[model samples]
Target: MITASLESARTVLSEVFGYDSFRGEQEAVVEHVVAGGDAVVLMPTGGGKSLCYQIPSIVRPGTGVVVSPLIALMADQVAALENLGVRAAYLNSTLTLDRVHEVERQFLDGELDVLYMAPERLVLPRTLDLLGRGSIALFAIDEAHCVSQWGHDFRSDYLGLHVLADRFPGVPRIALTATATRATHAELTERLSLQDARHFVASFDRPNIEYRIVPKDGPRAQLIDFITTEHPGHCGIVYCLSRRGVDQLAEALNARGIAALPYHAGLPQEVRAGNQARFLREDGLVMVATIAFGMGIDKPDVRFVAHVDLPRSVEGYYQETGRAGRDGLPSTAWMAYGLGDVVSQRRLIESGEGDEAFKRRSMSHLDAMLALCETVDCRRVQLLSYFGEDSGPCGNCDTCKNPPATWDATVEVQKLLSALIRLDRERDQRFGSGQVIDVLRGKAGDRSRASRHEELSVWGVGADLSEAQWRTVIRQALARSLVVSHGDYGVLVPGPAGGPVLRGEERVFLREDPAAKKAGRSRRGGPQGRAAAPIELEPADAALFEQLRSWRAEQAKEQGVPAYVVFNDATLYGVVEAKPASIGELGGISGVGQKKLDRYGEAVLGIVSGAGTSDAEAPDREPG
Candidate 1:
């Protein structure tokens, strides 16, 4: 009894898009947009947010103008749409004038279904004039968080997008971002002039990624060891903070017999483009790059994301790590942090232009990241909590699975904060954490002697703890908002709440540093320790995994896409475990899209059958 309009929409969803139905709130969002309502969607990465806009764009009468931030993203999206026989084209700086004119002619002739443009290009007078002539369906702003100053990828051009709605009065608009805190979300909505727009906020949990933070003791060697021993033959990204670091790591990885390529802004435009193309097309290649690369990379088979250095903020960290296991595959999010990283990041922030408030906010964010690195609790839960989502302990992160012990650090905290207060009084606020620690430990070094704090009563109170232990306490105190480090005057001061605790009105229990905690062996005395190994596959299942991987490799070769674009390791592992017999059951897996199911479901199921596996379900382990 469905009407013609509804029936046609459903047909497109199933037949063209290869989706049987909408996921989460996608249907409602699509209907709202198709009905010409403005929307602001805050969906997490890999949550199918694209369909919320793409479906409506196709179902509505006119061409959808998708405003994307990255040139690579626009091209990749257009390519994917074209693969589905959707008429899509992009106009960006990369295109020549002749091609731009041709695309414009097509847009005016109604030959395109969706046209993607960068925010910088879309704000142009000529571009706006052409868009006025077309029947504009919707204006979708992807990565909309970039419009806010608080966001990691802030772009001034994005603020100009508000004019699109003003210029084209009747067209619907949607702004989407994967990572945005409540504050950032409010700012984005206001800046985009979407006060009247409907809002869609999806859960920010990425349950499949296993988070781990290892101390940066010989980071390069550890990286080489991890890739070779733990996750051999897997595709991963190694993120560094600098272009020089990227180049060095790439060279080191190549020397160690791993295929790694360097990608950064310093490289020639064409060379960077070529390197990225190669990484996307080849299997088992590691890309060592700065944050400049890998924004709109569609490769889903990235099995790991390792940071050779610390990211500036949690938002940047989450976005970088979220790139892994996008196909809902089991992957590792690993990083190596050390004292030097803390100093380097702080220096970079201090070098930027900002007032007191901006600097304090930036420092607070960095302190939180440092706390995350030093945490002995579940990394996944902690990360989700930062984004305003809460979850029970995820057993997949390193600390949760193998719980670290705790110690009473109430006395130690008092001693450290008191030392800061004493140093502030003595030096008139001209010292950092190291000098404060030195004065407390009663070290007669030149720096401490120059401050004239060696004779203070609290100077040697914390001498009982080792240098490493003091560092841990300082980081924890900072994390708990018990202290703050000022960069301008370079002083360590008590935080707002630190006063009461120093006065003995409050008590705090602290987790022992993981490195200081005792290491135990598994009951069976294996290297994996007492924590149960992530569910292991039987020989037949392992064989099937290899076959699936090989088949994926072949398909990737044919399409010139990463193997993950065909199937992620997690999906392949799920197949080995679930042994789904039909397309319906295969589609039930977390990351199996309808297009992927229709294209490769039977072959995947065939591997299951050949392994003599029945459609048996295994008990789900706490996702570690």
Candidate 2:
């Protein structure tokens, strides 16, 4: 007689996943889902969301049908599962007819543990018929937020996934997403028919990512300095607002001796796929791209995500930045913002084909993003609050690292507001922040001359500060609601708060702009604005880590999968840190599951014992 219970899930986690215990609500979620119940899991990126479904799939009978959105995700996950000695296969357009028949035969014979397929294929009549003929362990709808109309990376195919619950009434379903707002949450539950599913929301904070946004001053140099110093010898991502920008930046970085590749929808499919595979297989590679490249990426060691331009909303920003530091070690979320970004984003919104109501909602999201960028207080509190959660100062963001010095900018703010008002109300002219700054800085450009803005008393009256400093004042004022911001041309009018500040009826405090910025890794007693350096290791261990990586690279090359699929940095670091003397001791470390311990443990022990070579230690095993 066979015996397995919820307790067995714990054993599966340790033996298969190489973890001694579950994190956060993982155990509860796993147990509930394994007990034939549904779930709506809202965990942050890298929060062990996969385990919630994976462990349950193992604990129960039959095959786990995981509905994945991207082929890369399915392939990567299948590679990982196979490395753990689990019987996993994927069906998509990339597969041959013979391969499909073989996999189907295997599943029919009850030889497969998991079957991953895309939503479109899974919902097919033939595919669904095939699944109905066999036993299904469970259904896991991954990236469930794609069903959300308002979420980033919406997929229409996700709409048809609700039929899983209808067609397989007795089967348990678990809908999971790494990013979801309240609106997205409601839509996911309704669209996926997961209303009865138990909900689990973990903390949204990714404290490993150090948030930092700097003024866009000489952006090229700034980016270079940040990458060379803050992210030396690290795999990172640089996000740009435009495809042209991505290509240009990638070229620039390459010219500067940094290996970078551009990725966007504009690139050829084969080229994009090749670049992505190279990035996963290689080390210290940087990918410069738009949002098209990030979703469902399983690379675990992205050390940083730098933005050359601002994102449209805080939700998008959070999801993008969360891509970094997935391994939970220290990483950076660095960005450079300026007035031009605001103007361009506003222009795009107003010029979009959406109706007035949709445009208004878009603008509201942009305004909230501006507020976050200009915030001098706790960024985590502001970010969490936007998502209906409350949090204290996280001390990991730039603002918390070196609190901004607030200065009473009552007079300067009034002058800038007066300029915007005179240009907009009195003259019937709307100018963007750039032109308005010119008027305030006493530089009467052609636009100022044509609009007769130079004739206004507010023009050239506040030349005490430079243009950059005045721009800071204007941006902060807009963030604090002291000035109204709108229109494609950067039209600025008087808000209710603006009138009070302009009438001397209210006070405005602005963060002072530092004269010269110093960019690099954060050092002890170092100047403000440097990033915290990564964890240092002793020379011997560091050398040993490299050797271990070299060995893993060979194994991955043989398996034709990502090097991380063989072993991640954390596991490798643990091996180096512990220097396990025996196979039993090695099994005690995290990430050394029974399957991996059997495959690589002997080889690893030999290297540590100085008895075998990195390349010579590994023995040939059955092909995955």
Candidate 3:
């Protein structure tokens, strides 16, 4: 049996994980779990949530049975812990029979600190029997939001997890997730039967990520420019709405001499795995994928995440964007938004097989997403507000840095509404935005001309405005629910809210079309903003940093692991900034836990003292 106390937790945190202290609610959560209490921790992606449970597992008796959602995540996490000299093992489908038996024997012999398995495997009767025969310190359910049926990354396998509460009675259970709305939070609590558990909700803010949503104008070109100019040769993820889009975008990026890969469910399993492996192991390769990717990624140096299409909900957007800059360096969350994206999302919600309540929930999610895209306020503030947190402007997002201008669009909106009214009243027809805009702009296409919309009084009223400007009008209207998309063709009809606007009871102000802007280096000197500077070192220390990175790369290559598994950029930053001359001094630095200190302390000292034989020809640049 192991001793459990906050003191032991702190010791494990320093000796095993190499952290000097707990961040945010981590200390309280760790103390609670170590004292044999239950907890529900809601922290951001890079908020050091894993330590809350990881420390307690080491402090308490027996192995920690961690139920993760992905095999990739389980493998990656186990590898990382093993590198820290923790006796961690995992049982997943990828393991051979003999390897599985060895892990099981390790677990039964109480030699494992943490044992991980997918939820599917954990729910099996054989697996449960094996767990029943061993000593268990605690049960950790990572990615706890998956239990929420309406959450962005729901999994049916999570429903069976509630059994842990009843089966493992006194084994202190802790549930954790990076993103969740109040409804999802409540659902996670109830579904997982954690009503009595203490809830520790941290701020859902990723200050390191700069949020920017722009009007879609040649979005593919915009993406290319964003990558090449602002984040050239940096690892990133580009999200597309369809597999074909993923394939085409990956090919287009590759054609432009960017190393890019495509990932979606349609690809063969081996192909997807190979692509994912390469993306993890290689440096500066972008992954163009659909929503099927990036649930439990452990990569810490992703520089940016770009979306060519609108996500289904704000929660989904936040979750996906949170994948960037997990190491707390500067990064960007960018999206290309337009009227077509709104219509496409609306059509999907209306044409689905869900019940009325489900459709209503989905539409609510979409409306919130639209509001985020169209908001003139700080995007980070609005995003956090959705999750029931209050904060002032972050001064890091696009709106905070370069606020957009808005114009009195009342006349333009009245003209668009009048055209819709005329078509409905006189012609008994409704049309999509393209046809309606064509009628208003006095450039009636064949479809609009066939309907004789040219005879309408509102036909040529909007001729002064360009089509792109009119699109802004329509998108803002839809965002405000002044107009609603209906039927399979996404035809626009006056919404209930539009009654007040049409009656002149409410004034309309729309954001002016912003000029195409690409993020540039921020004048502010901190890890904040889109082009914020990463860790900076003096000239001599910078050279030392490069040499240290080269040695790390060689070590990772020899071990067949991602370079970060040896030492993340943040750790190396600590090493470079400290410039320790002795092994004891090196071990005192953050992230230089006892295991790593014993393993690489001397070599790090050598690098710092200019005595180490670094593989100079090795890659010197850190993988983004």
Please, what is the TM-score per model?
0.82, 0.93, 0.94
For residue 576, model 1's alpha carbon misses the true position, in angstroms, by: 6.7
Q: Residue-wise lDDT of candidate 2 within 73-175, one digit each (tens)? A: 6787899999998899999998999999999998888888888999999989999999999988999999898998777668999999999989999999999
* Highest TM-score against the true fold, candidate: 3
> What digit string (tens of lDDT, one per residue) describes model 3 on residues 1-624?
434487788888889888888889999999889899999999999898888888888888999998898896677788899999888999999999999999999999999999998999999999999999999999999999999977988899999999898888989999999989999999999999999999999999999999998899889988987787677667899999999999999999999877899999999999999898887776678999999999888888888999999999998999999999999988999999999899999999999988999999999999999989888899999999999999999999989998989999888888888889999999999999988889889995788778888888887899999888888899999999889899889999998788877888889998887767665343333221132235555668767777877788788888878878889878888888888766667777878888887677767776776777543422232211
TM-score of model 3 (CA atoms): 0.94
lDDT to native, each model: 0.78, 0.83, 0.87
Clashing pairs in 1: 301-564, 329-570, 396-624, 440-459
Best candidate, lDDT? 3
Better lDDT candidate (1, 3)? 3
Task: Give a tens-digit lDDT track for model 1, residues 502-586.
Answer: 9999987776655622222223212221111133566666667777777777776787665555665666777777878677777
Model 1 is weakest, by summed lDDT over 10 consecutive residues, at 524-533
Q: Give the C-alpha lDDT of model 1.
A: 0.78
Point out the worst 10-residue segment of candidate 2 by lDDT.
Answer: 524-533
* Residue 159 displacement in candidate 1 (angstroms): 1.2
